[model samples]
Target: MSTFSLDTATVLAAGDASEHRVLIISLFVAFVLATLGITIWAGRQTKDATDFYAGGRSFTGFQNGLAISGDYMSAASFLGIAGAIALFGYDGFLYSIGFLVAWLIALLLVAEPLRNSGRFTMGDVLAFRMRQRPVRTAAGVSTIVVSIFYLLAQMAGAGALVALLLGISSEAGKIAIVILVGIVMILYVAIGGMKGTTWVQMIKAVLLIAGTLLITALVMFKFNWNISSLLGAAAENSGKGAAFLEPGLKYGVDSMTKIDFISLGLALVLGTAGLPHILIRFYTVPTARVARKSVNWAIGIIGGFYLMTIALGFGAAALLKQETIIESNAAGNTAAPLLAQEIGGGAGSAGGAILLAIISAVAFATILAVVAGLTLASSSSFAHDLYVNVIRKGNASEKEEVRAARWSTVGIGGAAIFLGVFARDLNVAFLVALAFAVAASANLPTILYSLFWKRFTTQGALWSIYGGLASSVLLVLFSPVVSGAPSAMFPGVDFQWFPLSNPGLISIPLGFLLGWVGTLVSKEQPNIDKYAELEVRSLTGTHAH
Candidate 1:
């Protein structure tokens, strides 16, 4: 007989490894079955490209709002941010707040006008006033780039979840998640189209909010419902508590980190309004007004969701105990789940175990819903903008376009999966920041200038998109991901070479400058008057005719 002496920590750590694999597999299988069922149901309604791309433009503001929330509150928002807050304290909360505040930009500036002007993609908004082929082509390329980056981040989160929950190798876990997400998302796009994706997002959004709320409540109950005591205890237990409440000098307090935080905040806030995948969701609504209302609704829900994360973070800190967190890789990401198990008195405890199970399951579902939305956005850009406009000169049949979109979804999903598998050990939070930088740089400048600037021309748009894309990508590659310097990716690199991990501060201005320069260099085309008038009416609801 083998005998093992178990310390309290070891016993706690080893508490119920028996049913974890079974629970994970069962939850995953349930997710697969539900997603497949939705796809099969949605397949029956998909009759043409428009139906597939925009759900026949029939969703209510509330339904679309929920879907938008689902798309926005991804795995990064759920697991990553919670983990960050648990680990870093106040800085993580800053990220959550920054992300939520960006929707204000959407509600006030982009939402109504975006839906009023575009049909399938942001290319439609750009092409509405410029050379159709060039603008659409540029927009398509930008969409693919941004979407792929976003997809990679989401897939990385999914793989990490599987590995953490199931105790599998990251590579193997990534493969399983990729195949599951890719196959499920492809089917949703190919068959159910926009309707299917929207419904999935809606359902998942509800599940996510409920799951998080339940965990938060339970966590508070375990901490005796005393907020001050909880905070004090957490702080006493971990030296990180003081820094966690007040943003660090690097992220929030220090001058240099403050500048970086502000820049990152700007990128996240503005970038949400300009993200191609997110913008496309407006077209799923029945009218521009509905799109406007949808943004308002999304703001409320998303805001509430972020608020709850504060309690969740505190719960992790107060109940999970500091020693357990340090032993579990020093990353706060595991704090919440670990807390759940401990409070439940091990995995054998029915209540805590079930709650943990549900939270993990919801995290997986969150990834699927968000990735499906992204895949649809990227695929539509390829099929409707690139294939139909550039390759076929807008003469392709609806069926042909729909087929192309379906195939493109599969391709993009597969590419994201491959990248996630290869980079399984990489930090996804950084990838998400990169996505925001690209969106802020490439897409936001073009969208904002086109909507508000009367002098904006095709030349300016082209310059802004390409210049922003190039600058952001180059800055990231050289910053840390590629160069193993000192900090996270490049910890030892000279500070002069890369002062900040995020490039939005420098690159966003460069994008604007390039756009202005391009406009000055090119004489205003004769078509500017007509296009500007159309855009004005679209914004103000005045018909020039």
Candidate 2:
């Protein structure tokens, strides 16, 4: 490691707090007002369950693609990954690749079949050939758990991010920010429904992509249009020197760390296709062809954005010192903003204030778009899979189901806000990792088998969902995140027994294994006729549902 004086790092000076606050608040108000207006328009048009849950199947391929980008690129991607790259160098770039590559799974396997079969939620597809109640119940549980876990991280990050951006020192202010986000997200789903949510996501995607492009272009200009020089300077300023440009700094070359890296890779690559929020995006389009086209469009946009992140991350490392970034926020969550302030003009300049405000407001919009998607997925699963089909014996009217979904949105949103206040100290990336592990473990295998397998039984589907969900949760509870040493979440308690923080390596295989074993041991005969019908429909997009 290179010996560099931490105290010598240049600190970006702060401008007038009142000015920054005014700019940020004004931009945020404009975004919220626009989305709320869309919600009102969508609400007036939403007359039944189909419109509320799937935007009346009206979104085009390009429109759904923008919405997908908005829902997928969360604050974690904008802030957390950029910060990691600033602090850890090459390892952070790996995250971008993992996130982008996962679209292949979505495109090649899940998207077409899912759109061809599922109507409202993921359970609709999984339970198509299997016994409805038990399978739907299992899928519903997994959907809720994954969505809530993911939502908690976004909500907590919102609170912390707003507090940092606005210079709000009080804990109460942070809680207020969390509640505000939760309430707005709830309204987006409960009132505007999926049409409103899709429009918000599309608008947010445009703003986010534009903001990232502007920042990246400025960073490139600062380097005088030389990549080699930029990398060299980033190495020199990183204090770790050349090692910062290589791997093994963030995740070392040890055996367990290697396994941890693989586990994380599995979750990231396989998990995107399994996410209920993303899966629901396909239902917004009217045709399987449109759904496939949406994924293709999403791949182009998402891939390009990740490339920009690579630039932004290295830009922060080269232009700003490590110590300065840590001092702003230990987790480096504020690195992107600090970079925005620097490249626009040194801090306190008019250019700096304006650029910082634009990026901050975009980040706030990112959180809202993602949380709304998750809330819709979770509440729709509860209302459609459990309440209407399971409890009411599929006798409930469309209006009743829509009413149940609205109430479920409020309940889930409230729970997320409550949990977020207490979990404000948790790492955003770590929470995201747990959500991914559960999605990959519990949902991916079932979806794949349901779509392709001829002998997949109801028992197998239920076993896979419950087993994968259980293994992921149990392993996380015993992993380093819960307890290990002073830096762990439960520092006072040392109950960590698992070697790795992520459980995808073990849980994913176990999930597939249980599904296989459950199929082999089942006495119930496979319904060949149903399988034939599902296969024909899934392949040809005819008579779906």
The numbered model that scores best in lDDT is 2
Can you write out model 1's per-residue Cα lDDT over 1-545, one digit (the tens) per residue? Answer: 00001011111233454466577579878876887788778778878766798888888998888889988987656654665666667776777888888988888888888777677888987877777887788889889998888877777666666665666545555578556666776777767788888888998999999988877777678667877776776665656757656757236556777776777777888789878778989888777778888888898899998888877776677666666665663445566566666666655787666656776788778878888888889999999999999999989988888889888887887888788776556554456677788888988888888777778788988999899989888887766444564335445554335556678898889888988898889875737676667677668645411
Cα deviation in Å at residue 323, candidate 1?
4.4
Clashing pairs for model 2 are none
For each candidate, give its TM-score against the true structure. Answer: 0.91, 0.95
What is the Cα-based lDDT of residue 543 in candidate 1? 46
Predicted structure 2, TM vs. truth:
0.95
Candidate 1: where is the Cα deviation over 4 Å?
Answer: 1-17, 163-167, 170-177, 240-244, 249-254, 329-331, 346-348, 485-496, 524-526, 541-545
For residues 360-382, what per-residue lDDT tens digits would candidate 2 score against the true structure?
88988888899999999999999
Listed per model in order, the count of residue pairs whose N, CA or C atoms clash below 3 Å is 12, 0
| Cα RMSD for predicted model 2 | 3.9
